[model samples]
Target: MSDSAPTEHVLLTPGPTPLHPRAVAALLRPMLGHMDPEVFAINDEIQADLRTMYGTAPDTFTALLSGTGSLGMEAGFANLVESGDEVLVCVNGSFGARMAEMAERYGARVRVVTAPHGQAVRVEDVAAQLSGVQMVAVVHGETSTGVLNPVPEIAQLLRGTDTLLTVDAVTTAGMQPFDMQGWGVDYAYTGAQKCLSAPPGVAPVAISERALARFAARRTPTPLWYCDFEGLRDYWSRRAYHHTVPVNLHFAFHAALRAALDEGMTVRQRRVREMGAAIQTALAPLGFSPYVQREAERLPTVLALRLPEGFDDAGIRAALRRREISVTGGLGPTAGLIWRLGLMGEAARPAPYRALMTALEDLLGERGVAARFDEALAGVPV
Candidate 1:
């Protein structure tokens, strides 16, 4: 590996979005022992803040892990699901499919209920597939398609059932409204990088008492040692030193959580909605349309747009790269046909929207696609 590789400041990708200056500074702060009194205090404060951000009162058991959002998924399954247990996974995008794969890896009988790439999963469809299911897992925000699943409705449908309701809120956590308690979600996980504006190493997970009880009564040992929820809770709660916690990452997460609370969840939600609407409005005149049909079903943090006819997705991406912009290509089935744009955390602003639109217009012009940049930009709010 060469150390001289050029690096860019722009991060327009779906995840690991731009970090706030305060969060970056927190990462550079003096490290402390995981068992240090001050560090434990910070950890306790962050757990409380996570509960607030997740909109769950006393029902959630929250933890901060030293990995990405995928770790939370593994932890969720490893703790709640057991060998021969039936798990129903609702798949609409790449992340949804990952849930099924993770459950199967834990020896659970995985049944996937899939919707088309750009469509939202209907609650009725999920209920229909819930027969004999021990757990129901869904991605609240389909990051690959920018479709927001009706999590509350899905939760309500699963109410009073024996099945546990697990949700992946990686792309929607702080950027949108999620009521873990009100929605009756048993387990929910989110990455710090997306809406929280923290560095990528930490994943915040919230589990309901119901889910913890299931974990306590597991018939078999959890397949993964690192992700065992009972052990992790003992470590985080009792400070028993299960593993050396990532001290600096915890600092970054604490700073990010403070920022989120300071900004207020309502304020953050409004900013996301406004930014998303602005981008959609601006892109319409450029002949770009959103993959999601209903605005209500769209995630404010991530946007998926269809490529214009005859335009090369990779070529345009390369052109943007020369200009220091870094939008990403589609994933899985949507590859080459669509582009995923992230307006997460601090990037959910008018200035970044303007910059991206400007670069896109220039790239389209170079590719012989007629684009009216001024007209497209005029639609955005000042």
Candidate 2:
């Protein structure tokens, strides 16, 4: 071994979090070819785990797409939408708006129902607009503003209608409760990085049989091939080649999935939920408040905060970097206006949480906030 020590770095950014120890070890495993029969077995296992993660039916077709979450989102739209279809996209943050854009690109006549950046999408508004809509798309966790939309309630409204519900669960899958069957979600996709504590590249997706039937009956052929449900499903189910699979990422993702299951979904969700809450609650006295005002609507995995007056965004963030800690500033409309702290995966652990608290207090020179944060951290299981 090299004499040099490996410095401990904390990742509070959204994607590409530090890998879990199991994933790290899996990455060093012997490589396999895409054509290797064992590769397909691993794929089957990952798909089954994804179904468990999404709470989909056993027959729900699942696959690990060889792309990022953005591609996964695009594939989701490509499969569900057709020319002239009326797609209802509920936009509360950047990701929601991206879904609307994706729908329009796929030739859907898109209608948008928007809420303020930091608020939840109103189920009543969605209920009023369900007429003639072929599909209703929403984001489960709005990472940009840290708002958790009411997907269950929105899914409920689509129950009797022919409208299928597609959800962007990029940031919530492994760390939160994703009951696609229970919530009546027809299609859902998530990246490997965010809550899975794995490297980015693969996007795990699930499509209910209802959604597949809708794809089968599409008036127009899906314009995209790589993301088309039929081709990809054949590749996964029959080992037919549509595209070169990311075999190495598969190893790491499999390990990550097993780790998540081993920890028990309920326990992991609680850890993520409690970690974000305690950190943000303690921040109250430190001159920081959550960007999303309502507690009920806030996303626990990603915490968006309104920085105190005259807070130095650059200098402080740089200082934290010096301490080997990382967090991100806001994007788009909220840029430089808020800070997004990702209490995801291993970052949700007590050591990192405590380090963040101590660093913030040191940087802000706010002992009172430190006291309150310590008190709050004491109660958090993470």
TM-score of each: 0.93, 0.95
Where is model 2 more than 4 Å wrong at Cα?
A: 1-3, 368-372
Candidate 2, which ten residues in sequence have the lowest lDDT sum?
Answer: 366-375
- Residues 332-355, candidate 2: write the lDDT tens digits: 998878999887777777777677
What C-alpha lDDT do the candidate models reach, one value each?
A: 0.84, 0.87
User: What would you estimate as the lDDT of candidate 2?
Assistant: 0.87
- List clashing residue pairs in candidate 1: none
